[model samples]
Target: MTAKFHAFLQNGTWELVPYDASMNVVGSKWVFKIKRHLDGSIDRYKARLVSQGFTQVPGVDFTKTFSPVVKPATVCTILALVVSCGWDIWQLDVHNTFLNGFIAETIFVHQPKGFEDNNYLHHCKPSLFIYSREKITIYVHVYVDDILITGSSSAHVSHLISNLSQTFDLKDLGPLHYFLGIEFHRDAFELILSQRKYILDHLLKINLAAAKPVSSSMATSFQLSRFTREPLSDSTQYRSIVGALQYVTLARPDVAFAVNKVCQFLQSPTDEHWGAVKRNLRYLKGTIDSGLIFSAHSSDTLIAYFDADWASFPNDRRSTGGYGIFLGSHLTLWRAKKQPTIAWSSIEDEFRALANTTTELL
Candidate 1:
């Protein structure tokens, strides 16, 4: 670890100095992990020095923090495009991506322990990549230390990694297989996306592996209303249900509407709501193998569908609006939301729903 820090310093990755007249330095720590192969063999020892980014203030430490990731729909569309056009699909990963992103704010960080220069113990300067190259169309999807770097060419991707590795101690993971719990499988004909392992693990964790599955997410008789005969005594169960359902939506858009409906009652749930939540879980049991499968046969054309249930809630009289966007045969994006304003007519409600969907589409 000391040797790695010395290499980082020699490469001009960061310069340690006294805290200057700039933003406060966030604290940092070393994280160590052991990499293991699928066969359970020891792969390598990994070490990371990371900033405590949670301490960063929203506007002060960072503004416009929204970094667009390749959405599920986008992923499907890209895969479909690869299939249709027969474009070679390759996945590349970056090592220590956050270290490459240049900080716009004059943020400082504490000198890493044990490797701190005695003469420069007070502060450390930022050496992020974004700070140095403003014009490059370099976008990175970061999940802590792991990163997925997508580019138009393998050479471009290689160049970016080469440049980055020059500055930081980096290990290249050739192609992406598992990212953010989603598993990827690629072949000459198709690129498959699934979370079968994740789903099974989740079900086992919630003690629902043996539960009976249902045909649909909710029953036709099920109606969620704001008014309830009795309030739920345990709120933790309600939150747990919501969290589980949220993860279920990764591959199961069918449950999205039902989950969204139940989520609306999170603040004040009732016995009826709890029953509905259980019903959704039971539905998951039957459809455990169900997930979004993005085939390479999909097209590039984009189409969207929108619908609404006006005044569906008896308590609030709020309408529920839902929209789904498709690229070719693959569904890329869908959203279920409640309308902000009450409408007197179905036409008015539908029109408002269209407006909302348009905003999202734009």
Candidate 2:
């Protein structure tokens, strides 16, 4: 993986230069994994070179880092339009896509292991830019190395892919089946999105395969308090559970509030919190097949809903604000967070939540 990234850098894909005095360089690390076949056979050993984006300081390293993404509703709307118009929808992937993005901040990456250029000995520079070539629409969705590219015409898609292939070795996966862990299936009538495989894998990983599933994500009367019976000995285990549940909520919004509530206790979890976390896993066992599905729909309108619970947190008297945004029938974004300030009334709390949601929407 390091070698591949080094080659990408060498070919004017992206570059490593001196870190800017004003910008903080986010860390990078190599992720190693093994690929497997559908039948559980080993495919090959793989490695991912990723940026430790968590360290990025919001305004210094990146201003306006939030990139607008196609909502699930938008995706569904497009699918529905395709179905109604009888237009062919094809998926194209651009391999090593982040390499194409020009970094505005001066940044440097340690020469990849085993493939370092000894001659350079010091610094390297990037050569690619948005205007380097014009055959392709540069709009690309990047989540690490995996990318999904779409264009208005097949010819445009083909031209873009051809141009990208010239820069780096490109793999044509043909049509969008799976990207970003979401499974997609399209036919003449409709398109379906689900995370069945991911959910099953998650359940098994958390040892909840045989656990009895719950009907809903949380109990109706369930409430969490920072004060609990006994402190957990290992906070790491609690955090691991929180991390797993966070991923599961990607397809399961029913558990978003519960999961976000429990995540706050990662720093000092208790037995009560642990029990609730386990219950969430049990809930997952039953809803392993549940996922956001975008069908053929007519709505292209975007709407948002916001709410807040005043003084919900007993420890700090902080309110919890929740919001969900929808493009049409599909839920695109949802957040549950503890407000920073204490609210005197429910109305004030709701106002704050609305402000936050509006900021996010804009």
Candidate 3:
């Protein structure tokens, strides 16, 4: 706590002031977290003092809320391009990210509980920043404080790092081994991206670490319906695990269909839906190392494959359709979702899937 307060003082985060009853003072609290490495080992402990923004009036204390976030597809597409082009991939982290932002609001917050220096202070995201020029392009993708950088030339990329270091307290993490929960492993021929540790961590969270692994994400004979089985007495865990599984699909497209099936019942999930969720996790347990592979020698030819399950949903007779898009030999994008409307025949369902795929291709 002392160290955190000292760092806040060093950053000129806030000034101590006498309490005024007329002022709309906000409360502050310290948040502590453990920073872990890709191997699930502790790296360091972190502390941050944040304002309880929930206490303020929206239009008065704050007018608008905006955070710049890069799309998952954008990151995957660029990564594939970089690997295919034989470019360098680097990672960076900006310290005290919240202290660097420019704020126009006049706000006051109570001093932290334990280390009150008789003062009050006021406070604060694009996830991606890119620089591109003719024959030279540098991509600086920021996920909060952590950044993933890649470009055409190693020299220019290092120059950018030097410049960034001079401007902000930054750490160049050298090679993009990990970024935004995805781990990158590079070799002579291909770049393998996976979430092995991420999967295990979540599996342990739900106490499925020792469960038997399954080869398939879903049961081939299982049917999904809103009214099947008894409704879960509590759906919080079901919803939470399923949501995490949805993110897992970012790298494991094979489970996309299974995840989508369980997600349909999120509003009121039943025991059967919960069981489906566990099955997906078990599948992940067996294939924790599975991920997208980007080959260095692959072509840039874009190809797509789409398919549909005709009248798969017994309740509504709606078909589920999905598509996988490959950039060269790398699978960069894919989605598994139920069709918007019912189709009478399998051929019509397939055509609808093709139309969706074509739209995504463009």
Best candidate (score: lDDT)? 3
The true-versus-predicted C-alpha distance at residue 118 of model 3, in Å, is 2.0
TM-score against native, each model: 0.75, 0.76, 0.84
Tens digits of per-residue lDDT for model 2, 1-362: 75557556666654556545554545557778876543347856776666777776677767765443444334544444444444544444444445344558755555555655677645433211122245533334434454455544567657777887886566677777766566776775556666666666666776777888787767767778878689998888789768877876666677889898888888888999988988887777776666665545546567899998899788899999999877666566788889988998888998999999998666
The alpha-carbon deviation from the true structure for residue 29 of candidate 1, after best TM-score superposition, in angstroms, is: 5.1
> Which candidate comes out best when scored by TM-score?
3
Please, what are the lDDT tens digits per residue for candidate 3 over residues 1-362? Answer: 67667656766877766666677888888899898888788977887778888999999888887766677877888889888888888888876655346779778888787886433333210766677788888887877677888889899999988988876678778888978788889987788889898899899998999999999998799898988899999999998898898888888888899999999998999988888899999999999999988888888889999999999998899999999998888888899999989998999999999999999888
Pairs of colliding residues, candidate 3: 16-119, 127-142
Off by over 4 Å in 2: 1-6, 9-30, 36-43, 49-110, 116-139
Estimate candidate 3's alpha-carbon lDDT, on a 0 to 1 scale. 0.84
Candidate 1 has an lDDT of 0.69
Per residue, candidate 1 scores C-alpha lDDT tens digits across 254-320 of 8889998899889889988877887787777777656666666766777889999889877778898
Q: lDDT score, residue 334, model 1?
A: 84
Q: Cα deviation in Å at residue 128, candidate 3?
A: 3.4
* Model 1 Cα shift for residue 272 (angstroms): 4.5
The TM-score obtained by model 2 is 0.76
Deviating ranges (above 4 Å) for candidate 3: 1-28, 50-65, 99-125, 316-318, 339-352
